[model samples]
Target: MDLETVMQELEALGKERMKKMYISNGAHEPLFGVATGAMKPFSKIIKKNQPLADELYATGNYDAMYFAGVIADPMAMTEEDFERWMDGAYFYMLSDYVVAVTLAETDIAQAVADKWIASGEELKMSAGWSCYCWLLGSRKDSEFSASKLSNMLDQVANTIHHSPERTKSAMNNFIYTVGISYLPLHEKAFETAKAVGPVEMKREKKKSSILLASENIQKELDRGRLGFKRKYVRC
Candidate 1:
């Protein structure tokens, strides 16, 4: 469908509760607050439409931007295009979930993510780390370099506590992802998580979240999910 029709459908699916939640999570006006699941049927209908996705993302509506990620053709996008998208991502949900998730599907995923990780911008760093988490959780362990991953785990152990709140959360998740999904560095990731200990992620109004990657990794291990890799990164 077209952008207008899609926006209308998304607006029709909007809910007050979800809108409030999005606002609380840093979304601004012009959003319809449609649930991500609610957009699935239309996503199937629209499939991957780079042009339409660009139009929707440019709208600056939270739900529309999210839907843009759902319909975006990652393989067709350039690093410049992804950089443009990253420029529009204003919050953790958009950066880490939408932009990073879409980037994880591309061949340039690691290259671009590396640049973003080194960007030193809060959301960019968060998205870069989160992109790694998505990649490790879905792609085969053989696709990654064990030494690089080991160094990343060391980086998390050394710097996560002092990183930005969102970056810390993503870094903690990176440790857990390496522990559970990337078998080559599981032991190293475990050691890193233990050394990192609990990470405090401060929120605007909510209580700070205590993120313990070691504990989360142990929980997954308890469930016999060690070395687990998902078939897909996005739903």
Candidate 2:
């Protein structure tokens, strides 16, 4: 489908209830409030349309950008494309989940992740951390850097308290991904989680919640989902 058709479909599917939810979760204006799941069919239809994905993202509408990630051809994307997306990404949905997951499957994933993590911007840093987590989660034990990941685990344990809210949440998710996807570090990550304590996240307006890393890890372990690597991070 074309970009205009996609936007029209998104607008048709948008709901005021979803708009309030996205806003509460830090989404900006120009959003159609289309639910993530609602974008799937459209994504599948336009999955190979790189130009369409680019056009959708360029529109700067949150829902369209969200959909762009769903349809974007990560392997075909240039570093410039990734850079533009990162620069325009202003919220966690676009930065941390959409762009991060899309890039995590690419050849330059690690390079892009390292560069973004070094950024002073909260959105960039969070996206960087999230990209790293997803890449790590999808790799085999032989390809992963245990020592480096462990060191990052230690960093989160030490500095998550002082990191930006989004960065802290990404770090917490990183730790969880590490524990759940890397058996060698599962125990160590559990220890790090206990040491780091609670990960506090700001929800809509005045609401907030704490995610207990240790508890989440334990639950995954009990469910026998530990060390299960995903084939892809998208969706």
TM-scores for every candidate against the unseen true structure: 0.99, 0.94
Misplaced by over 4 Å in model 2 are: 202-204
Give the per-residue lDDT digits (tens) of candidate 2, residues 1-235: 7778889999999999999988887788898899889888867766667788889999999998988888888999988899999988988988988899889979999888878887877889899889988987898877777898888888788888878888888988988988898888888998999888887877545767787889899999899998889886887
Residue pairs with colliding backbones in model 1 are none
lDDT of each: 0.93, 0.86
lDDT of 1 by residue, 145-229 (tens): 8888888888888888899999999999999999999987888889888888888999998999999999999999999999788
lDDT for residue 125 in candidate 2, whole number 0-100: 88
Residue range with the least summed lDDT across 10 consecutive positions in model 1: 149-158
Q: State the weakest 10-residue window (summed lDDT) of model 2.
A: 202-211
* Candidate 1 ranges beyond 4 A from true positions: none
- Report residue 122 deviation for candidate 2 (angstroms): 0.9
User: Alpha-carbon error at 35 in model 2, in Å?
Assistant: 1.5
